[model samples]
Target: MAEKHFKYVIVGGGVAAGYAAREFSKLGVNPGELAIISKESVAPYERPALSKGYLFPEGSARLPGFHVCVGSGGERLLPEWYTDKGISLILSTEIVKADLASKTLTSAADETFKYETLIIATGSTVFKLSDFGVEGADAKNIFYLREIDDADKLVEAIKEKRNGKAVVVGGGYIGLELSAALRINNFDVSMVFPEPWCMPRLFTAGIAAFYEDFYTNKGVNIIKGTVASGFGTNANGEVTDVKLKDGRVLDADIVVVGVGAKPLTTLFKGQLEEDKGGIKTDSSFKTSIPDVYAVGDVATFPLKLYNDIRRVEHVDHARKSAEQAVKAIIASEQGQSIEEYDYLPYFYSRAFDLSWQFYGDNVGDCIIFGDCSPASATHKFGAYWVKDGKVVGAFLESGSPEENQAIAKVARVQPPAGSLDQLLNEGLAFASKI
Candidate 1:
């Protein structure tokens, strides 16, 4: 078996891996000292694009164009960049075994890698319907968007099944984005979810109402309060229909499932301390094991701002957490101290000419503000979550650059929430001032 050793190794080539590499370069990592092992054939690109622009029928995004750092308005690190930095980009290598105690990782190809320090950036895997024995879930063209390869497959399906009926089974970020993408491609689209409103984990009823109305007006079918119980396939083993738990079957030329995702932590399951389905980590992203750290969706670290532990799966947190982990590593090496990670949860999505940004915790009493009418031409609106007489979260749809920044500040500052009438009257103005 072939063997390699490096001063640093980051497992899983995803958003976190890319950003961590950039951070390492920034901190003056020596050539040939660091290596990144990934199962993906290509270098890490912005994952969020897989569900957004990548699905666009025209002017769609492609590789090298949306690589790491670009998503955060930084320099794009293409494969050449890794080569220039002398960072080993071990693409298409899946680490089948991770021995934390020996600081070793074994690839599926029987290659072994030893590292002085390790950063776990395995990210998450999509929940497949087949896992639950959903009948006929294995049919062709039944897609899930988690990686670039998955997006590529969906794009091919979209072309082959042009102007066909598409069913999206999920109401979260992927479901909303993919549904919009299919609709944009002129496909008759229908969304299926078991919740009364989309993004139930974040969006309030008022917020969801505006989106549901807008999507309906745009000719997209919204089927809520039911789950996809099974699928139907043609003689060719291609999905032709979706059977819902509510006893309704809808014809579909393509099916996209985005129910949810679980962190990829099985390799180190027994060796690492897990919390809430992720590896438990300190504010610096260091796991319980020595010379080991975890970041991205796999690490549940202390949310210093909220005084709690959280595992954020959003791209924003993924980028920031990777940077934090690298900073912690470099600081420790230099015998210096750096501030702990203080993350303010941020999430956003765009579809059908509507864009929204959310920040901070979505807990406590939610107060709707501004004009959220789906029929309105502007369709500008926002919401605030008031907890303990303080605004803990803010959401704004169709906000300008400055306006979005203002709401982000409102969420971070978490100022005292005044009277309901006052807040409603002030609306965006309230955030602008803050």
Candidate 2:
């Protein structure tokens, strides 16, 4: 009933939190009014290049060593960035509960920070394979490659395995990327994918074949359609074999488990409305509790590309969605109208010698156009023009001059009638057929 005092109290100082705060400041709000809480001990940076150094091994200064980072663009925070912005950066802090009804965030230290509005950008953690009860699953040799800590473990394990053999489970983006890095380190690497094809959800069968052959050519053993029931270890507590559902065993000294990651929204249980591993938000990124909004991998909202359902996970997804969250906070402050946030989902991965780029299609209905075959190296580029049949979703590789433009416009919205047909020409364009 009274006028709320605080402007914003953002939890989890990752990309979303920092970007939301920067946006808030652009709206003329002072930094002293906002609280940035992060478990990482510095301001948020970027992570675009962390894997590069670990993959390259020549030890370039551009790629230093770090773990558990909430940074950006290969660099951590300068400390002065927050101070200059007048933001109260709380590091090594964790928010245990959201007292949404009281408009407060309770920390583990028995402190409550009152907020007129709150943003939760708590990201995600790697999914561990230990649940399946692989023998020696919790052993020191097995690691989930998610945070910087995982990367460090991977680096050490790869070095140790250089004298022996290493295995990676699940052939999704992370697994594939790590596979390439391990191979680069001269470790005899083997990848175990549950699915018959690589990245079955993201790429078409053709694209998958291209990558399969690519990784195989690099001397990495590729095993498909194998569901690993668990792991095996020697008496020394070192991983020695990986047991498969199909009854095959792999010998290895180091194991990198990259099954997947789930949103770290579990901490908000009972404190916020959510389905799955993310908090719910509306068009304005506002939670059911007034004055509280959610963003990043921890938040969910109807994304048009996802058929207007709350979707989570991805770097660009967080940035674009949080942009809307920031705008929502400012609009609510000024009594201005707010617009819904929707984006075409996109993701990428590097495996062996191939780079994979993807966009849209959470449920997989789409049309492919290009030399998407593994037998031919001609079409390093692949494109997809998808529609709900009601609306189109387009995705493409970074190349393909004309196709890139078409996919871009189609993602914003389908072109004014007939354009979809032109994109779907059944006749061959190179044959001079009309």
Candidate 3:
């Protein structure tokens, strides 16, 4: 028998879909009115902790779903949220295809769901160079840690190869955090960078250079100005070396390609119009296909600062975009005009020896705080007060012990020139003025 048509159908089980379901329920959308189909058996939870818990020592595995604020602890869960709302959870299923003409979605189990509105929060996957045919991968142990399985593989390798050596190929958040985790697991870690400094796309040289020394001091073999071409394996068919672009190599038991992630919209297969190969959506989060909307890493929605250039594969983007998608869906249902998603973008990572954060408008003109030290063997701590004349855009960190209260001024918007230094003398109350 065919299930009743839902007022709305949301695909994907990540934060975007979860947030949407919560809002739909809050708006008094009938308990039985919504159908949320998710691929993850587990409800939406934190994504960063995947690497953290997987890398935990034998006795340090964190209690799952437990949370504490100040001193209180409990699990903030979705099953209860879903139950109270009468949200049908079709878990462990995939929405294989949909008929835009017929307005129906066929699931893997051959179950069918028709909807008045649809959301495509399918998210994205890590981009592997094999898809691009880039050479360098041989019998080496190359890893791309994105999903739970990928992190599980890393954990297994860590248990078997404690004190082993691993090379991290990218300098992005995932790469940095994974490398740090490996080190904490007692693995010898060598971090290779595509740029002279760290997080070049996100930080000023001042802040990037600081982290260079910090990681090195924390037992990370820093390799800047080097590019990994591929990986090499030994006679046992395991990675033993990382082949470099200029014919050099780094000894390795595992090669982690933190190269970055791309939208998982590949399977969308032209069913949705794309901008730069990612599904495109308007401010309302509506895609070119009627009743279908996209969010999370799969979306190339407008960045009010980046001249509307859409980007993929960032956690901040996922959380904020998901929230925006829920708002847009609710507004539309109430016959209200949809508002575009615009906000100060933020993201962060907890790696070995430091907790780092990036907040605010990153691109555009800006002034920097701290010094861009010369790259050599000696390391220094650095911070960047990246800013445009009009507003402060970013705060770049280099494992500094400073209170960093100054960065808060720029967090809302850029502080004034010399304003940071003045705050160093003043305090958090100092206005970040132009």
* TM values, all candidates: 0.99, 0.84, 0.83
Q: Pick the candidate with the highest lDDT.
A: 1
Q: Rate the local accuracy (lDDT) of all candidates.
A: 0.93, 0.67, 0.67
lDDT winner, 1 or 2 = 1
**What RMSD, rounded to one decimal, does every model reach?**
0.8, 4.6, 4.5
Model 3 spans with C-alpha error above 4 angstroms: 1-5, 58-63, 66-75, 78-81, 108-110, 134-141, 304-309, 364-388, 396-434
Residue-pair clashes per candidate: 0, 9, 6
Model 2 per-residue lDDT tens digits across residues 1-434 = 23324567788876676677667666777858887888766566444344545555666223223321333333334566568777788888777876677777767776767887788788887777777566567766887755444566666666666657888888887777777777887878899988878777676676577677777878789999886777787787877888888999888888878788788876667877886557888867787777777787877787755566665687677666777888877887788878677676667554444554554553424445556555555545554444444324444443454544444555555433234455445312311221
Instruction: List, residue by residue over 159-258, the lDDT tens digit for candidate 1.
Output: 9999999999999998899889999999999999999999999998888998988899888899999999999998999999999999999999999999
- List, residue by residue over 110-192, the lDDT tens digit for candidate 3: 88889888887777777775766656564546778765667667777778877888888888776777777888888899998
Maximum-TM-score candidate: 1
Model 1: number of backbone collisions: 0
Task: Indicate the TM-score of model 2.
Answer: 0.84
Error of 2 at 322 (Å): 1.7
Which one wins by TM-score: 2 or 3? 2
Error of 3 at 300 (Å): 2.5
